[model samples]
Target: MTEDLMLLQEKVTLLRSEGKYKETIEACQHLLEWGMAANDHKSVLVAHLHKIASYYCIGDIEEAFNNIGTYIELCSIYGDELDKLNLNNILFLLYEFNKDFNKAKATLEVSIALGKKLNKYIIISNGYSNYSHIYCAEENYEDALKMAKEGLDTAKLLEPASPILELRVKLNMAKAYIGLENFEASKSLIDEMINDPILDSFIREKSNCYDLQGNWYSKQTLYREAFESYTVAKNLVESYNDVYLLKAIQAERCKLCDLMNDVQLGYLVQKEYIAILNQISNRELELVALRLNIKHSITDIEKKANTDYLTGLFNRKYIEYTANQWLEQASITNDNIVCIAFDIDNFKSINDTYGHLFGDEVIQHVSKSFSKKFGEHDLVGRYGGDEFIIILKNISLSDGKIKAEQIEESFKSIEMMKNGLSISITASIGVSDNSGGSVVTFTDLFQKADVELYKAKLLGKNQISCGS
Candidate 1:
């Protein structure tokens, strides 16, 4: 079995080295399955790390997080410096791709410290390059330029004429110069990189530099030169389909065409702008109407989709969706996630005691109190009739229970109305924690909260019960 595993690893390495990423990933998965079955922790760790690299190569940031997290944990536990460094690199890329600049900078700091301590010049150079990118994203152009220059200097000291590192640093410096309105400096940097005889293989980097150059040209009202730069940028951006660069280049092209009195081209640009505008409008409509209804907000369409017409809280579906999102974010961030399920005690009896119209007023009053006490972050949805669900974030178990009690107390203070009548109400509450790895799915959290809610009902109404 050991010999067979070794052979499999070798083949996997060969495939990966040959750039057969798909086949390499397949073999890695098979290895992972076998490792899990055998309960071999080392193999499991290696398989996970390799999978993270494959995922990074393919630009799947979210999927990489879970595996990368596991790998980071295992490497820290086992004191593997090399694994730690590799995970840091993958994490840097993942966070950058996800637009989490703060986390990316934090990860790069740790990676750079380790690389410097270990005298890993290549890793150190990569760390500087990535850190410069974070500074660039944060719009700290001075810091970005300094870091990029440091990276280039380090790479040059470690190895002579490193073309890739030089290209990256030059492009970064161009971006910094552009941000500083040092257009001449920016153009100089771009021209040097473009004239570099060895940059032939860095097509993407060169294209991006051209896009930045075009942006500077457009800003300076150099239309013909800007047109050439934007044309190349448009071609490159189209090939990549990068939304950020595409939008920027298209906007520049539109302005230049307008400036040049190209009416036909301007109309074409206007058509494309209209298309993008319509796309955004539809997306906003979907988000505001459907998603808000399914989540927490009141919209015209969702008002129809998720309201009882008589009561203004929520329909049944909204409660389930909001509860699930709360649970998921809590699980990922390791923060306290809690849910409160409650109902107006003796609601049917209240209708019987007074009238159905009075009962409707009691429901509305309770929901209004719920919305008032809970912040926008908390989810409050009516779960049919007198029942309601509230999902809270970033609160501890004790704090969550306190919140439930407060909601109950606040409800008692509200004066409900029928037509010209006043009435009072009481509610039974349940609370549950969604805070640990042992919790399998979001449903478990909901079920646990529901169980406590049942306990509250059983123990007698107008009280609260908490899940253990």
Candidate 2:
């Protein structure tokens, strides 16, 4: 059974290496079931840990947390001090990911205490390293520097010093110094790591060094030097096809562009950032669905998160968030902003005449049509049971009214079939614009459009009304 488990573990590794994250998780699940049935506590723990890694690789934070919960439970029941220490470290990372800084700090303290009690230098060093990173993230450069130095000192006292561990501490120290505006010290540390022959084999570390150098240069207003360093880091990560590193580099580049006041370049970089984020999000959703044995795909989860489940259009929460952001931007740029609110002409009657499911089909069809009619930058969301909202940027009132008319026409042309009967769909739309306003809020715009929509309904449905 142990040999079988080892073989299964190998298969999981191979699948993960091949980017088959779903298959890797499925194999881990099978191994876990076998371990439980065979009463193989060690194998069960290992399987759970493996599943956690696979879930993290696929960026499924929630699923990773679930597996970590099980792993921690098993560790308490059947693990050694070392296992407990490692589990605490994992818990620290999970809490950190959720931005629960207090919990992460507590977990790190537990790891440090256990490592000291067990006389484990590696664990002690790693705990300090992680603690330093947390401080750096929170902008506590002095504390970060102290923790990093402590970690390095502890690492140096190991019977056989670990160069990789030492290098990691050095990197943390460099970052802390960078945060402190001590460019010379930061440069010295980064240069030391780059000059070390032992570190040459670690491409990711090399890339990180360049990225830090880029950050330091950017902070000093050396835009050209920063760009060069960022390019080097990007090229190194690109050679390894490290998507996460690539994403980080792109984000840095975006910030640099913004700092340089290159709005066009910043916009391009922002688009790339969104694209990468979406990819990561989709991959995470896929791993989560697989772990839960759900039949839906990543796209399905994404759709359900941001869109109305029944109509397959953006949900109210998403639209509100995005629309607020656009409104803020419009205020800064003096851009025209328009809001449209619309609902089915006789939605309640349709639901009463046909079944609710048939009514749902009508909503779905109309939502799809609205999605097709809008620009990529436009925002459309299901505001309520039978109502939808759209926010258009940099469009005039006349153009918005034209769009509203087009929407009404397109939706009215749709045919809904139920019980061998055909029904024509029509909608009433209310449009509002913030073209000449000093300041406009989402609530104000929504209310204005909604009032106009009421007027349209009162004047007879399947018509458009405009408001200033």
Model 2 segments beyond 4 Å from truth?
Answer: 2-20, 255-468
lDDT of 2: 0.83
Which lDDT tens digits does candidate 2 get at residues 208-288? Answer: 889888988888899868878997898888777676778888888887887788898788878977887887777667656
Q: How would you encode candidate 1's per-residue C-alpha lDDT over 88-109 as one tens digit per residue?
A: 7778888888899988988888
Residue 288 in model 2: shift from native, Å?
6.9
**lDDT of all the models against the reference?**
0.74, 0.83
List candidate 1 segments past 4 Å from native.
Answer: 6-26, 36-42, 53-60, 236-248, 259-261, 267-468
